[model samples]
Target: IAGRLRGLSAREARRSAEALAHELDIGPWMDRRALPEGGGLSGGIRRLTGFAMAIAAPAPLLILDEPTNDIDASRRRLLWDALRRRGDQGAGALLVTHNVAEAERIVDELVVLDRGRVVAAGSPARLRGTQDNDLRLELQLAPGAADPSELATAPPVRQRVRTGRRTLLTVAATDAARGVAWATAQREHGLLEGFTLAPATLEDAYLALTAPGAAPGSAELDPADPHQETAHV
Candidate 1:
């Protein structure tokens, strides 16, 4: 299969072998037909080679499993761009990735697995649109920062204080716009330095769906336990 697809012929194969070596910027490695042990190319080079080999075949459907793994961020972005371009050209691509941010950026659909079970499936926007959790705001205070407690007085629903050199604030998703308004008001009042708003992520959706009762970073199970099981001995 490899021979036929890679276009291996006595003359054509030799030419392709030479071309592949030159294309990959390697010399005399085609004679070995294998990368040097402990002297192999970088992750990006290997990934690019694999991608080139796949593109050389010009297959209709490309199944990439963790194509971005071990690749540098720049190369990962390049690969993503290439995949998107391929998809735009009507090529079918199935990308399996655990990086929610990357998936959000590239994937048109999502299939979530939990405990070996297919739990949820949909597009990224659809999934995120279904979530009701409020957006989060992180406020970075400048040097000689003033307290934000004044802005916290009897304001909105569900606010939490996070102390750092700067303060991090968590609020309900519905309150995001209002929170920004409040932050702006605080800025006017000289109670805040700078602020950022973050939307709900795929990780949030996964947590909400898979472990509804589990607190973030807390092992203490929810008292309003829904998934709590009474196992038979």
Candidate 2:
């Protein structure tokens, strides 16, 4: 139907749709109908179909809202590649998403919104600022952690932020090994489910910005409008 709507011949429509199905790794389910919630295709596949439909429309510019929301990592990579190809073919897209880490893989420009208001806008590199020089130690707290931050109090931990079971400890590059070893020991003591060490990304900057009364070096909010903050990263 997408091809017909686009005025493609019957054969062309089938070819186009099937090719897209293969691209989205949904070729095997081409004939199956999709249902919502507890329906035929899994929720993730249904979401993938929606993305396929949008791509089928062949819009010169697409407004995608969290297109990769339910998608797994491999298929998500396919989606990103598909969009990059579309851009190469002269199409454009305005992608809206909250998966900051994943979105960094493909977004050419980013606009971070906080409570429906713009908080920051820039290319990923521009937004990361000096964050690349810092290492992030991510810890997954065990169930019912009374104080997940107890492990973050040590020296190398220049900053620590906790949300739910996830905790991000920021430290300078020189302290990367020490930070990792400390988090490793904590994991052994059953304080953490797991932990990973990596360079901080835009998400780190974003968290610091939205954090109530964040420090001046990372971000600064206009005193006149508390809601507005400039992300220096």
Candidate 3:
């Protein structure tokens, strides 16, 4: 059944396998009929074969579910490169992954699903940029510190406090610029310690959208406004 879809005979499949081995940078294994030591070669061979078979089928669209699983980081990077190349040449791919960082790198579009429903869909930038008002700020503070209630109460901005030796502050997206400025001013005035701004990420959006029912001081999120809600827990 697979052979028919790939348009290749057994002999042709073997030849195609050789070509795929090279494409996946596993050409050294192609010369040996037997798998290599520690079973690594067999897995590599299987992955390369599947990848090659997908490419050889002349399909306009390819769907991969967790292609990077059980693969080393280097090979994972190669796989993403291959997919991106295919995408650039006008082929469409539906990639399902929990690895948001990898998805952010290669996928032009994103469909976020929650409980088998389409919760959000757009380009990566568009989806992530939806929460332009939210900012993640990391602080470096002295040990045995108290809560940041002083800073939190200064502005009318909604704040969620994560306390440790250092504090992680989540401020409203609209208040980010002003909030950060205020924090920096406090630091300069010996109120807080060192700090850095963390980049906003798809993970942030996912958490906010999927967090359980809201608690006090946190607003109930609107699914339509992907950016305004605080990530609980």
Candidate 4:
């Protein structure tokens, strides 16, 4: 109906919408109603439908607000891919989202905002901060671990971020073994449900760049870069 109203022939509009639906793997819900009340497509499915409708339009610029919220991992990947295709075709987009970890790989440039102020802006690599040599140890604290913050005191642990029962520890790449050993000991002692030690990621850098003492902002834009960028706030 949207396509037809936009001057697209029924067949053309349907093909466009269906193609997008399948691309996002929501093909099964194409015929469902997006009723406002109840018994319609689910929250995730409804979001997918809205996404299809947006891309179906011939808009040159797309402003996406938390497009991946409530979306599953696989479909979230598909949605990002669809946006990438849109960029490849010369259209541009402004992606407003807090899921920087998921959007990191796709973003050509990243702009970090703190309290409505632009705290940092640059290519993902440039903003990775001084922690390029760092690794992240994500610890899933056990119920018995009364205070997870104490783990930050481990000799090689350089930085830490804790939210609820999960704690992420930043350690030097050279000390990966020691960090893993420490987490393993905690897990062995039942202080952790389980823990994962991996190399630092864009999300880790995002946390660092947004730390209290970070410089106001400094980044040179590359005019030659793609116009589609993700803004992380």
Q: Per-residue alpha-carbon lDDT of model 3 for 89-165, expressed as tens digits?
A: 88999889988888887888877766665556676655553355556665666555554534435543333334355
Best by lDDT: 2
Q: Whole-model Cα lDDT per candidate?
A: 0.59, 0.73, 0.62, 0.72
- Where does the lowest 10-residue lDDT sum fall in candidate 4? 219-228
Query: How does residue 225 of candidate 3 score in lDDT?
Result: 48
Q: How far off is residue 137 in model 1, in Å?
A: 4.3
For model 4, residues 1-233, the per-residue Cα lDDT tens digits are 77777778989998988788779998887777666663566777877777887788677898888988888888988998999999998888888899878667888886888788887777776665435677778989887576444745463555555667877776678888877777787778788898887876777666655666554652222223342122333
lDDT of 2 by residue, 1-233 (tens): 87778777888888888988999999888898666563888767877888887787466898899898888889989988988999888898999888888777788888777666565667775555444577778888989755444634544555566777987776678988877777777777788899888887778667865666555334342244332224542
Tens-digit lDDT track of model 1 for 183-209:
787777776777888865555455444
Error of 3 at 37 (Å): 16
Backbone clashes in model 1: 4
Q: Which stretches of candidate 1 lie over 4 Å from their true place?
A: 1-38, 130-134, 137-174, 177-196, 212-233
Model 3, runs deviating above 4 Å:
1-5, 8-16, 31-45, 130-135, 139-196, 214-233
TM-score of each: 0.56, 0.70, 0.64, 0.69
Give per-residue lDDT, candidate 2, residue 84: 92
How does candidate 4 fare on TM-score? Answer: 0.69
Residue 138 shift from truth in candidate 4, angstroms: 5.8
Best by TM-score: 2
Ranking by TM-score: 2, 4, 3, 1
